[model samples]
Target: MSVNVPKPITALEALERAQWIAFAPFVFQAARVLRDRGILLAIERSREGLTLEEVAATAELPIYGTRVVLEAGLGIGLVTEVDGRYRITKTGVYVQHDPMTRANFDFTRDVNYHGIAALDAAVASGKPEGLKVFGEWPTVYAGLSQLPESVRKSWFQFDHYYSDGAFGAALPLVFAGKPKRLLDIGGNTGKWAAACMKHDPDVEVTLMDLPGQLRNAEQNLREAGLLARARFHEADLLDERSAIPTGFDAIWMSQFLDCFSEAEIVSILRRCVAAAGPNCKIYILEAFWDRQRFEAASFCLQMTSLYFTAIANGTSQMYRSTTFLACVHAAGLEVEREHDDLGVSHTLLVCRPRPM
Candidate 1:
């Protein structure tokens, strides 16, 4: 690929595309109103198409309001109009039904909608200035459990939807050596640790994270009857004085390191390197923008990096694989093997201690 790429669209087309971005906020809200008001569903169910009156009646909305939203949806490609009736479009089908679309939509709307306006402030201050909308916490992680019930649900749905698919595929590789003791760093919700124990009846797992997150993970593990095999360590990785627990056969970090900056990642990995025995395996599961199979996935990741900047943590963003690799090497670890294109957008790197 060339560093300087030629333009693919004409100037007229570029200007037309620019208009879509200019009205994006209005268009997004229009789509949401149509979906939530049942206007889209009413149109979708009609065998032929829904007349303006029919849509208004079915959705129990005023014809004046319904007409404007339908017209907006038509221009947005969420709905199509023929003569005088409206029908759902292919794009609308995905907007209303796709799992990934739903997760991203709810997350963006519920959690990021208002906060994202502070992007410029966060960029200038090097802090999550948008997090002020929720509370005066160091990061979103610290205030996660205390967020509104609906907001918390959206966060978890967005977080788990991306990682749940990768866990099944990565589980076998992590246990290929049949590690007896595994340390799950940043074990959010205990999902991966539970999966490991279920996959291997004899493997004992330890969860290390902040005190609050540990409580949530403990409750989840207990509910699954896996607590007998699970242990919890309240840890604060940012504290340089804190020492990570040692003597584990395998150390796992899945979508965890990406939550930190490169400097923080190096510091955390150094702790992992210090803790690992000679034969220990350190696995990292992440979605690197450069490693994505599709341009759309890459675009989504690029935009999501802004969420980290504006809301999650000001210093961290989803990293390219090359940048992430330097951190691992800096911590005295080397990638023994790399498996890309795992279950959903993830690259699994199996790292081992560097030789003297």
Candidate 2:
């Protein structure tokens, strides 16, 4: 099968990369601690590299702790040291100040770090063994509403970072048919619903998801003064018997299907097919790995799939476009239009339920 992979590297260079891999987890925590403790910021504030003594003084940490983290930061390419003084590297500044990078870092540490410890077990069992770290649930969605405030913050921010930007671009495509009503499947926190209401004053949306999630969505819609234009439905789409309310002109699933396994995705789509009228338009927005323009972006998505295995749901991953298309066909949906590069990493597939 054809795949897009990075160019080959020399044996010595590969070995150096392997060394970083061996120390990555430890190095990640060191960077987190350093950032949290103000060591990195203190170093960055110094035009000239700061002496170990100065960093310790500014960070209010013991000299030994500061030295260890700074040394590891050097190894991680987050900082540089010369003649007993340290300064932030270009990479270090991004980690220190960039919003996206900071969000990714916090998400990886606060939400996925401990759970990732059970990755091997999750892989072996085909279950979210690491999810036990938070609480017992088949998937993270069941417990998303109850996650600690910090974890929930990072989780939502990480999710919205990639998806929120796509809303403006997606609006015209979704409203191209001027549908009076839309069904937003898996509409967490009602962000998309609010966007829809604002984009088309006459359009009304029904936000559907698990009951726990709808509470969050209701709160958001209420805050946005969109409660009148929005309706809520609580159902687990994974259950074959759970009915999807019908009669909407459009159905929108944004960054939603990636939460389930291949079979579950097919099942959900089939349900959509059952609920959707012949004329209903279905829009699925996903960040498929193979569709990414940059190898780095693809690489980030490939790693995030592991987060699904260990923490989110053991069955899903960042999918390839072909894989999602296959599921669409299996569910008797035809891709009527395809939009790519909608945001930093999303591709929108506009579909129609195939005739029986």
Candidate 3:
């Protein structure tokens, strides 16, 4: 039987979606407040559902605040009202409890909420205007170590939530050749370096990143007792002349290239190729927008691309798989192996320098 493909949304559905977008800020905070203030939890625990009075009492909130927020939740579809009672919908349940959703929500709230206001200007000027909210940095990465504690917590949580799961599945693929030396580019906080040391006792790992970033990463590796196996090479890749040290058996870039524009990525790849010896394998792991299995995941990535525009770096975007592949070819590299759906939403591209 032929599968029934979904058609375009009807006019009414389109209008509804438009309205949701128009009031997204209000709706987002309503859901956040509902979840954070315990109102949603109170409603979920009630088998028969909750009246505004009961919700207020249970959550220790004033009835006036409870009623208005729950009323907004009805419009947001996070809660439904029947016979003057409120209960959490399936989406509401996920919003309140799903780990990934919770992380993304907190990230949106704590990191992007105020900064996003400068999006239009950031786009117009091709600069991270939102970054001014935190400090005078060209990109968020430069200011990461200096960001407020809460912002740092949420940012790292969101970053690791997506990448950490892929490490367990990626380790074996990276070590398949039994390489004694490995280089991990953009090895933030040295988590991947530590994991590499733990995975193979004989392997020595070199972590390359900015000097400020290496400070935290080096400390972590030292505390984990992986310092002997892990070394640090600090250099800013944005500098055209920045050199990547040569002679490693394998190189790894996990969610790293997405932090750069297409041009920058190509330049960085060329540097990697220049440093790669014969028989060296280069691994590029990223959540390519076009490679996602679900449209929702793709949508999430596209939305995140805007975050890069307004907050992280204005030039970078979450690239399509095809776009990234072209950069690899431009750098005189070929994909020797491709791994997708490893964990969460990542795709791993194992590459080798093209024969001269």
The lDDT for every candidate, in the order shown, is 0.90, 0.90, 0.91
Best by lDDT: 3
Weakest 10 consecutive residues, lDDT, candidate 3? 1-10
Q: Model 1 segments beyond 4 Å from truth?
A: 1-7
Query: Each prediction's Cα RMSD?
Result: 1.6, 1.5, 2.2
lDDT of 3 at 28: 93
Tens digit per residue, CA lDDT, model 1, 1-356 = 12123459999999989999999889889988988888877788887999999999998889999889899998999999898989899999888888998888888888998999999999999899999999999999989889999999999998898888899999999999899999999999999999999999999999999998999999999999999999999998988777889989999999899889899999999999899999899999998888887777787788788889999999898888889999999999999999988876899999998998
Q: Give model 3 RMSD, 1 decimal.
A: 2.2
Clashing pairs in 3: none
Distance from true position, residue 218, model 1, in Å?
Answer: 1.0
Between the candidate structures 1 and 3, which one is better when assessed by lDDT? 3
What is the TM-score of each predicted model, taking all chains together?
0.97, 0.97, 0.96
Q: Clashing residue pairs in candidate 2, if any?
A: none
Global fold similarity of model 3 (TM-score): 0.96
lDDT of 3 at 8: 92
Q: lDDT for model 1, on a 0 to 1 scale?
A: 0.90
Q: Which stretches of candidate 3 lie over 4 Å from their true place?
A: 1-6
* Ranking according to TM-score, highest score first: 1, 2, 3
**How displaced is residue 11 in candidate 2, in Å?**
1.3
